[model samples]
Target: MAFSNDVKIKALVACARCCCICHKFCGIKIECHHIIQEADGGSNSFENCIPLCFDCHADMLSYDDKHPKGTKYRPDELKFHRDGWTSKINAARPADYCDEHRKLDQGLFLRILRRLPWNGSIGFISTNNFAGFSFDCRALLDLHELAACNDDPSWEFIDPTLEIARANLAHHVSRFLGLIGMNTFPTDNPDRNSVPEEWERERPEHFFQVVDEIHEAASRCVDSYKTLLREGRRRLAIESPADEEPTSKPKT
Candidate 1:
């Protein structure tokens, strides 16, 4: 479901700066963005969110082709001040958004998750104590072409339930990584500047790239899932006789 209006307002109200692109600074005309996507299982919770102008949002959406869950600045990219604004978003995010696609089996959903490369696993969060890719993306395995982790024994689907659990875990991890941007190494994204370099050279293509990447990953995930049901053993994978697929992940 689309995020609620109430959530939107709360997010906007917390804005610290106007959007870099549009100069808008409020929710009605401007917009708020979670560094991590609420759809990617990122929480609507304030800790992982940011408010921006519609122009800035548009700019970011056009910033890269590989962005689906949107992007995040690297941890070290932000600036710190005297009052103690640490300049780091919590960077926590959920692993999946099964609720958004309520027409698939657990196993198939997992097959899709397996195919998606966990880019965030490189260095995305500080969960309680975790840092620099503290988690294992190998366990978040599946099958695919464009973004496979190429882990053979690394991915072994047990039953449908276990597979779903693994995918759910992967969903959160992906959310975490995407919330931190393409690289988690040091969060080196530049701060709010007048204009960035990429804007001049090939911006529209960059936006198209983000669109393509998200579509490719999401489409691949959805498409493979259908195949999973036919060739696999998730109860709901069959054409007719089966159980209902599970719902959203446990609230994280």
Candidate 2:
């Protein structure tokens, strides 16, 4: 069969959901433009299409015009394929983020993190496998940007595998917390409305306060361990345990 009708509908739905990148961002317009011009040798394929701001489409067609009267593109331009989140934005994205952010591998927020004089130690806790935790970093960076902008979406997935990856990652986070004694977070409400309800009334708090307390307890335990280590080091420093202080014979 030719291009699936569902695919085209997906493209259109994405455009409307993001408002064609028109409403939220500067460069995006409401049209999905073919990266490789349809006239040359391109076919109706997902790779050939990208969501373009209206002006970008026109600018792309005219790119060669800037060079000369009979100028041409390098063969690479015709066959090029951008990868990662950038490609996702071009293909389609959540309604909240702009095309510019979507097209980024690390997106805009991490770009700022990279630029800083110090490498920020942002700890991401998730499953070890790429299949499990790959999307967490990119999604987190995007969420950081969203918060900065004071707007966002419920979720973002860069790859089809991302959904499964996230579920596994959540498992890891839960397991890690269990090891440390913190418990389920956010709330017990099935709907997660953030409203107080009867189910949570039985629980002390609807958040991870116990988790914080356990961490503090763990820190104090380390001090006792350190004292043992220091005592051992002092004993090791002396050739013997001072010869057991020479047995004192009591003279009666």
Q: How accurate locally, in lDDT, is each candidate?
A: 0.36, 0.34
In model 2, the Cα lDDT at residue 176 comes to 35
Evaluate candidate 2 by giving its C-alpha RMSD to the native, one decimal. Answer: 22.3
The local lDDT score (0 to 100) that residue 193 gets in candidate 1 is: 15
> Which candidate achieves the best TM-score against the true structure?
2
lDDT of 2 by residue, 69-188 (tens): 544544345334223334444444335545554444223223322321111111221211111111222322422332233212223334212312222222222333343322322344
Error of 1 at 21 (Å): 8.9
Please give, for residues 76-143, the per-residue lDDT of candidate 1 as tens digits: 23111101121211111113424432244443445443443233211111111122112233322332
- What TM-score does structure 1 among the candidates reach? 0.25
Off by over 4 Å in 1: 20-27, 65-252
**lDDT score, candidate 2, position 17:** 24
